[model samples]
Target: MPDRDPLIRVTAMPADTNPYGGVFGGWLMSQMALGAGSLASRVGKGKAVVVSATDFAFPGAMAVGDELSVYCEIAATGTTSLTITAEGIARERNGEATVKVAQGTFKFVLLDENDRPREVAL
Candidate 1:
């Protein structure tokens, strides 16, 4: 909601909800990984592996039926790795954006044909 480019969008479903009808943290984390990995691979020009979640925070809850949007951008690059910052925004179907359900820094290493670290393409 801060005008950054959106990287992914998904709806919180019943299956993703917890007993209290809120989306599970693991589910949101997985989405962030996917978004970060996707950007890393594109910049690395090959497959990548998540090495660390350098930072993570949950500003609010994501309830079932909420529309979730994930935004990711490369924050840094190493010889064979990259660090990305991602933010997840949750918006209700009929209400305003209330929170950033999740945000974090994800590190990924570029891999070669043999699954070994290689120089980042970018």
Candidate 2:
């Protein structure tokens, strides 16, 4: 795992909450996917498709006032695919410390304009 900056950061909003008022797991997963996809696309130098989510774990809960951030970096590059690890962390609005909420490793394959697989640049 290499050191890199966060890929996406957004506040927990009411719209993203479940009936229990906590952030939804599916919503968090989507954000993680988007973050990983963005990094993979940039590395692939084109669009990419999520082939698989290797590992996904939720270690903490998220609330409305939490500041959530998704950090991602390239883990490996295949002939036509790139793998990235994404982590989600949340910090309380009143605190500076952040807690890891969830993490997952996703594989993305480069795609052409017609949504077909293409050889990645790297």
Candidate 3:
């Protein structure tokens, strides 16, 4: 876990697993997207949508009952966009052990009420 609070946290359920009975990678990536999107919107102070997602990696595995926590941080900023990095950590169901499961970078463009790209205040 990070020193700061996680942007998103949830437990893996049976439905979130693959046919092999392991937690699905897509599910983890979606959680990372949600976390990165939250930070983008909060920092942009308006609507923000992902333009691209890249550099995704899965370094560990988790079971259905494991808990997942996603942490995000701004990595860079552009005139109208933000690049955020997200990390996923999984904790054992009934223990304190934790391991990093996934990581990715997402680029987003801030949007105005018209849904057009707008300058980021940063």
The candidate that wins on TM-score is: 3
Worst 10 residues of 1 by lDDT: 1-10
Q: Write the per-residue lDDT of candidate 3 for residues 1-122, one digit (tens) a residue.
A: 56789999999999999999999999999999999999999999989999999999999999989999999999999999999999999999999899999999999999999999999996
Q: Give RMSD to native, each candidate.
A: 1.3, 2.3, 0.7
The order of the candidates by TM-score, greatest first, is 3, 1, 2
Predicted structure with the largest lDDT when compared to the true one = 3
lDDT per prediction? 0.87, 0.86, 0.95
Residue pairs that clash (backbone atoms under 3 angstroms), model 3 = none
TM-score of 1: 0.92
Identify the runs in model 3 with alpha carbons over 4 angstroms from their true place: none
lDDT of 1 by residue, 1-122 (tens): 66776777888889997777779998999999988888888888889999999688988898888988899998988888899999999988778865889999999998889998998765
Backbone clash numbers for all candidates listed: 0, 0, 0
Clashing pairs in 1: none
Positional deviation of 32 in candidate 1, in angstroms? 0.7
